[model samples]
Target: MISPSTSQVIPRAADSASTIKFRDLDRFFLGLLVLWASRAWFYPGDVETQIGVEAPFLFYFTLACQLLGFYGLFRLGPPRIGSALMSQPLLLALIGWGAVSMAWSSAPYNTFGMVRATLLMMMGCVYFRERLSLSDIVQTFAVVTGLVMVGSLIAAVFFNFGRGTGFHVGSWRGLFSHKNGLGEVSAFATLFFASYILAARRAQLWAALFLSVSTVCLIFSGSANALVTVGSGLALMGLAFVTSKLTPSKITNGLIFIVLAAIAIATTFTLVTVVANSLGRDMTFTGRTRIWEIYLRFAAQQPWTGWGWTTASTNEVMTNLVRTTLKLPYLRSPHSAYVGLAVELGYTGAALYVAWLGKTTVSALLGVARRNDKISILRASIAVGMAVFGFFEVSAGVLPCLWLAFLICTEPKKQVGPGKNARA
Candidate 1:
């Protein structure tokens, strides 16, 4: 017979082991939850339809995941709510403004729902940033996106899913409803894997494999916007790398780099315009300019506070007005996050977004100047990528995977004090 002391110790040890196992299982489930909430699969209708009228099943599933994930995070431990809120002041302000817009929203119900979803998503991002290390977050993104790339290939090859649709006949949309969806995700995957490869001291070969797959998907999807986003990311990465090497320290050097970057961006924009004209393409960006023109005209009518957050796509009257004005079939979105923001929340929201971008950019510059580390460079690249992608996509306007990634990747480093561990 065992002694009482030994028997008690055995139960205690078993409990300890069980706790460890539970923690691991919790992490696995949370990762899956993140993937589910990302809306990685193809929506049945036009992309704008997703914003206004998501499929019932998808909507409920995502809602459940978000609720569960938030609960799980709280169970893990009381989050540093103050720290999380302080880290994303402008983002919180933007969401608050969106909430306030519900008062005048054409579709107050929809605005209320979207605002709640956005708030939950932002909270989830904060929890993710708080809980995971930078490397862990990057790896999680890379792995999830790698699965998407692999699944896309399988869907395209065997099931012929998301292919051969009318005007987009030859484009390989894979598991996405549209080619641009596939392209955008693939572009982001490429960036994630690239960051993984750069940061990891080992297992780079695996990261490279995923990187290649993502690149191939990006090419097959045939999205010019995705191509531009990837190019912008690469350019920013290159710039960050160069800045880190040339001036690893000094605020003056960072300022100088910023000036050079501004000049380069202007020159690049001018060259792109010229090149598009030379290639016999209209400067309309495939009729997007017309859409922008019409949207801006509407926005000017409510310069201070527009129709309300997410009204551009959800409000029937607004959608009808835009469609009738443009006389274009299947043109629901403004096709630009900036324009969408201007239309939905007016100039106030637009200014807040600009301020947020400026804050992120400054933080990135400071990070590179201070640390000159791979993570800092990755953050800088993402900041630039978002700024560029926002011009062509509703990247910042909604609670999408891209926005989540931006929140996590560009978050400023937390200060660790005595007896404190940064990673959960």
Candidate 2:
């Protein structure tokens, strides 16, 4: 385990969010990435008369912001490359393999664009880690999610936006176009905020309030996957809080983390099964099994290389194959991130993804056990979320949450001098 660098100040802070430079353009750009991934109200409806912005304009604008955000990162300082890459080797491998796979992508044109966007998003996450302390970062996220929750409440009550489609009708969509999207954000908020409150003794009222409201919104969203993921995350954080009060030695800490991790994993898996069974649902994971079968069939044709990174649900070839092969309505994703990556990136990519996620989660779990800090707990919470949420949604690929959380956790604390952090 790497020693907590005297230079690394912000990694253990669950609170102490002072005034962030809210006017910073790079920060705004990162915020845009979150808003974009959240499927917020800004990008709603058809191409023509789609709110006020045109599709091409929005596309170029987003691209330009990403490019400039990269520049801002360089302007800040060279990243701690050795520490960053060493901490998350599989992540770099995943990206490297993804770039290579574009060469043979069945949807070559589409794949290139998708891969580039993913690369940019990951870069943006690194930039965010450099620019803001974890406390400020989490606080900023809390603020944004709070706004989203408020918007959802208003839309559900005043407007006609709550009665959404699929799985459960009349589910709340909030600021997003769909209830599943709503569940994703709401549950995310609940997970992070609950972890934060657990780690930090102060701000109970606000954090608890936010957590409660987000949990309610998550339930109202009615996505079984989201509900299960959120429940798992909250339960893990609660357990972390309970264990934190004990004064354990380093060896004891490791043992505790291992025990807690095992318990959390087993409990979450069992609860998810129970939750699904209670809903009277089959093992299809809401029609995902058929899609998974189709992808597996296609995958068998090129088990090693896959059709390339662009050949998942959104790929034209995938859509065509699904349409031709299955009588059920077409599916855009295999719905499982692990399987989806395998379809696009093959077994090698899938292995890297799993390895990377494991490292990220384990490292944070260790940190939480050692420090007994809310910030560390929050980190582990997000890591668990990535695995849980990614199981049923193509979240790791399309949503900003997973990568953002990973990059932030793995990023080395910015050093202001030989033995001091920027915050210090």
Candidate 3:
């Protein structure tokens, strides 16, 4: 790990955030390349059979670049790097879980791989934390979404299923193989761009355009979960704006946050059944519900140290749902990270994981509430957006969440005035 430079004084941290630099950008792009290549490379046929370059050589090349990039970043400031990594209790919890998994993981290699990816992504967030403003991140996401939408449009135009009747708009999957993944990505892009618009940056027209394209993409991808996540985020953003007038004392705000969170969780569970029925959506939840049910029962059986990671992908319970139930092919992941962890790691691990996230949520809410500064408030708002996203998506396991969270958590702790922070 590289140390922080001694020349600059770290600002008052609702929390301290690291700046992202050119090297950091390189590392991030390399990481993305490695991930995209892994889909084609890495883990070809069965161990006994030879698969053609199953593992992509590009992964190694990108990995090497990431290492160099990270090293350059670490050299900039040891103190900041170390402090950012160690100070957050939530982060500590994740590390602790990783340590435990290394010792007891059924699929040690897979667990190790996940740990490495998680840590690397987090480090990237720290590196970019200081350099990129929130607006910068938002704008970048908009640009990326625009490119994705363009690609999707081309695919739709070229890959026609019939004359005059092109592919189903709701089922159009762009670069990502899965429609839901596309929906989720577009939804996040929508939220990201909307965040900038709400922050009242000059890119209102661009942001609106991004949101329009992303909305079309979101509807095209047809992911119910994506809809929920994006809708909830927007709702929260609206609530924040509406409630801006009702400013309370810090202690009072914190208490209200706690109360509201508890209420939200409970209400979600109680109303989940009703909402499911009312939507009359697929009972399988596109196969996720079956997985959820299986995991729920399986967790009760062991409740502690799950069946462990399975490379074979044979375990019916691992996949949770059978073909008859969901009509989908055999899947390795349980769809939901939280469900997978609960079934594989048991309640103890799940609790620890939740505790970590809980801490992060609280810290973010506190940062937003306690800080009188405008920049701090924007940071807080982003934190809240992330928290809202977590409710619908089990992001603890996804690379994107790690990157987004790290970015939000590590932003510069500068002071600001209220007018600058207010939503447009």
Model 1 lDDT per residue over 366-416, tens place = 566555656666666666667766788774444546645555533755547
Counted clashes in each candidate structure: 0, 2, 19
lDDT of 2 at 341: 82
| TM-score per candidate, chains pooled | 0.87, 0.82, 0.70
Superposition error at 125 for model 1 (Å): 2.0
The best-first sequence of candidates by TM-score reads: 1, 2, 3
Error of 2 at 357 (Å): 0.8
Q: Model 2 off-target regions past 4 Å?
A: 1-26, 41-57, 77-87, 165-168, 267-285, 397-399, 402-424
Q: Name the candidate that leads on lDDT.
A: 1
Cα miss at 112, model 2 (Å)?
1.5
Estimate candidate 3's alpha-carbon lDDT, on a 0 to 1 scale: 0.51
lDDT by residue (246-354, candidate 2, tens digit) is: 6557557667767976976787668757887888765545767767788877777777787787578657656777867776443556778888888888888888888
Worst 10 residues of 2 by lDDT: 1-10
When sorted by lDDT, best at the front, the candidate numbers are 1, 2, 3
What does each candidate score in C-alpha RMSD?
A: 6.8, 5.3, 7.6
The worst-scoring run of ten residues by lDDT in candidate 3 lies at 1-10
The residue pairs that clash in candidate 1, if any, are: none
The global Cα lDDT (0 to 1) of model 2 is 0.66
